[model samples]
Structures are given as structure tokens and as C-alpha cells.
Target: MTLPDTPEQTPLTADTVLRYHLCWKHRDLDGVMALYHPDIQYHDFFQNRVLGFDELRDYVRASLPHAAGEDIVHSDRIRVDGCTAFIQYQVTVQGGDGLVAFQSSEAITVKDGLIWRINEYATLVRRNAKGSDRSSPRPATSRLGLSPRQLSTMAQDLEHYFQRQRPYLDPELDLQQVAEASGYSRNQISYLLNQVLGQSFYRYVNQARLQHLLASLDDSCTRMPVDDLAFAAGFNSLSAFYKCFREHTGLSPKAYVKQISLRART
Candidate 1:
């Protein structure tokens, strides 16, 4: 709860929060720390974390946009009421072409010219949900203590890891191996894949495998059978491979190959 202040405190609260926002935009750690009240508490509802001053340094550092062109888009202008200010924004998950994003809001309470408390809430915007014809944001859960911004970074990192390492090419690969190699805990990776990306771990891996196989099929000189290529691309079973392939290409493997051959002949 915030200390009660009259309308006279509105200007001060707005100024302080504007500065805090600029500090975050510029990736200024010390500037952000300077604005925080020593007894400040940051509550992240999405991750269920309640952080203090000392803990906030690392949290803020991880959240600040270190690189230009971060995906955060402000949904509304800052609105201040007495001693508290409100900010709302959305962070688009990377590597999905903006198909997925999280809507986040922050309620900052100012006290004695510094930030006293924060109540942060975020929800994952689902592009598609089972048994529903429409999409919407849901109450996201994360025990891994990752903020929405950090989850966006995690998405980018996972995509980069898949592209550069080609780990999906290993038929024996599992979520645990990815968690270990990617420098994240299984729960963290799982949260990113399931909560934010809206896909199971195995489904993500199979999608990568399918992409790999399709890329190989583009080579006219390649002569491997489709089933063999599927196994080589890390599918453990033919049925699984065919299902993934058809889901992606909307055609049977033989028909897809025939179409590619037709295009080449033309």
C-alpha cells in the first residue's frame, strides 16, 4: 500500500516516473537505482516475485533494453493519480514475427521524491487457444522469476541457439539437454516455450526438425528418401514425421516431393 498523498503530489510523482522511464529506456542502471526508495518493493505478479532494493539491481539490469529496437510498445500514456503513477505496455516475443506478445502494466508509488513501491502485472497474449475460435491474453504463470522483457530475450536466444547449433538434428535431443546447453533451467525454458510461445517442448523441436528436412528437400541434387530425411532431421518415428510434415505443408510427403520436382522441371 502507498502512503496517502493529496493532489499536490501528482506533479512530483509524474516527474519521478518520467525520469525512471527514461533511465530504463537508456539502460541506465545507476540512474534507476537512484530513483528507487531504499525501502522499495517491486511486485511482479506474472512471475510471482516480490523484490527489494538490493534484489532490484539485478532485476532491472536484466530488464533494461541493452540493445536498440527492443519490442516494447507503450499501450497507453502514463497517468498519475496523487502519489501513484500508472504505466502500461506490451512486449512482443521475439522470433515469432510479432505473433505473440505480453501485455504488462506497472503501478509505481512515489514517496519522498523517490519510488516507494511497484505493483507489476503481465499476461501472455495467446495467438490461438484450444477449443476456442478467438485469441486473447491469459494470466501467465512463471516461478522462474522472469519478467516479460526477459522472456522476450529468452525467445530470441532460443531461436538463435536453434539456428546456430542445429541441436534439433540430434534424434536423442530432449528438453533437459536444451536447458543445460542453453544456460537456463528446464522450468525457465519450459515456461518460455509453453507459456509465451504457446507450444510444447517436443512440438517446438519437431517444428525445427521439419524445417530442416524441408530445407534439404530444396536441393535438387539431394537423393535421400523422404522418410530417411525425416529420421536424419531428428524425427524418431515415421508417423510423427508425417504428421508434423502434413501439418506444416498441408500435403503428403510424396505429393510435396512431386510438387518440388515439378517446379524444378519447369
Candidate 2:
């Protein structure tokens, strides 16, 4: 797995790579996306270039259905340069007629400490392996028996939902609503957010709302009142808003707003 020749750089360790792989296997999109640079440019194997955060978000969302719950496996690092690295892997997805479709020789490019692009040059290694059945029963309870691939798909879907719908604005939003929006059930959503991601539903929603409020404060043209902004960000009460704001940003809403205003002035 020789990386392209580039300037000398520190390569990410195997442990780091394994950790990232587990995060992906866990279908933690937010966890995965946090690794990439904000201004990433993704080049697909089909020569499609996805530019910017929003574009990457959409591209990933659209690709999820095809890749979810597949037998994806990654191999050792090929090479690394400053802020860039590469890895090789193979993936097997269930195909029509109960066949196992294998894709080999996949390559991934990580830039600025995140996966910037993936170029898969693959062929079907084998087909029709035993026990390659695709059909499975959906979980009866809230917990979806989602493989890593399915969770990855759900995570991507949730990311798009967050960007487009801005569900964080409803402080009362719960696992059921989020599950409905993300096409999972209440139990599955609860398990993903609570067990997998290690965060409660309310905490996750509050964090998202706080982040939304922070972004709103960054807007130059909008001068929103604190109380209105709090409600708009989906905080049920002023006190809760204040408490969450302070906890998340380590500053009161007023102070955070003032800081943003000051930063904007500079």
C-alpha cells in the first residue's frame, strides 16, 4: 500500500486508524465527520468531485443506502504525508438473487486529519458465498439489529436530517421523533444515541440546539433577542437555555453573544 510520493509527514498510528474504523463500524457519522476538515473536497472513483461541507454531507447521504450493512473490511496503511494518508480495503454487499457481491482494492484518502475522498478500483472477487442471504427480520422492539453498515447508513441519514430539518429547534423532540425522521424506531434511536454514542436524547438535542444558537449568533445580519434565540434553538425554558448554554460554551448566553459580536467586529 504505497502512498503517492509527497512531502515528509507524520502518519497516523494503527491504533488511531483502528479507532476510526470502529467509529465508522459503529455508524457514528458525527464522530466520523468531526475528523474531516471543514473545507474538504471529495473525489469519487467515478471522477465526481464533491466540494465543501454541504456537498460532502449530501454525497454521503446518497451513498449510504448502497453501502449500509455491507461486509466492509479495511487493511493496513499504504502511505502517509503531512495531513494526508491512504488505506486499502474490500467490501462485500448483498446483491440480487441472494448473491454476495465483493468489491476489492478500495482506496481511501484522508486529508487534514479526515477522510477527504475515496477511490475504489474494485472487481467482484467472488460471488454466491454460502449464507449470503440478504433478507433479515427487522427488530421487534426499538433496537434495530443493524449491522455496522446499517448503522452507518442511519448515521448519514441523521446527518442530512439535522442539516435540512434543524430538528434541534424543538426542545421537546425525543427519541420517537428523531427515530421517525431518521427512519428508525424509538428504541433503535435511543440505543444508538444512548448506548452507541454514549449520550442521552435530551443531552444530544440540547448540544445540537446550543450549536445552532452559536451559529445563529455568528450571522452578521441577524440581531436576535436572547430569549427568542433560545426558544428558536428549541430550549423549552429560559433557565434551561441559560444552563445549557453555560454548560456547553462555558459562558452565559449574553456573554457568548457578546463574544461573537466582538469577534465579528474584528
Candidate 1 clashes between residue pairs 3 or more apart in a chain or in different chains: none
Error of 2 at 249 (Å): 1.6
lDDT score of model 1? 0.86
Which prediction has the highest lDDT against the true structure? 1
At residue 188, give the lDDT of candidate 2. 61
Off by over 4 Å in 2: 1-143
- For TM-score, the strongest prediction is 1
Per-prediction TM-score, please?
0.84, 0.48
Candidate 2 clash pair list: 1-78, 69-149, 69-150, 142-187, 142-188
Off by over 4 Å in 1: 1-8, 94-98, 129-140, 219-223, 261-266
- For residues 1-266, what per-residue lDDT tens digits would candidate 1 score against the true structure? 54768899999999999999998888899999999999999998877889999999999887887577788899999999999999999888865423788888999999999999999987767554353323455635666778889888888778889999999999999999999999989988887877677678889999989989999999888899999999999999999999988888889999999999999899
For model 1, what is the error of residue 193's alpha carbon versus the real structure, in angstroms, after optimal superposition? 2.4
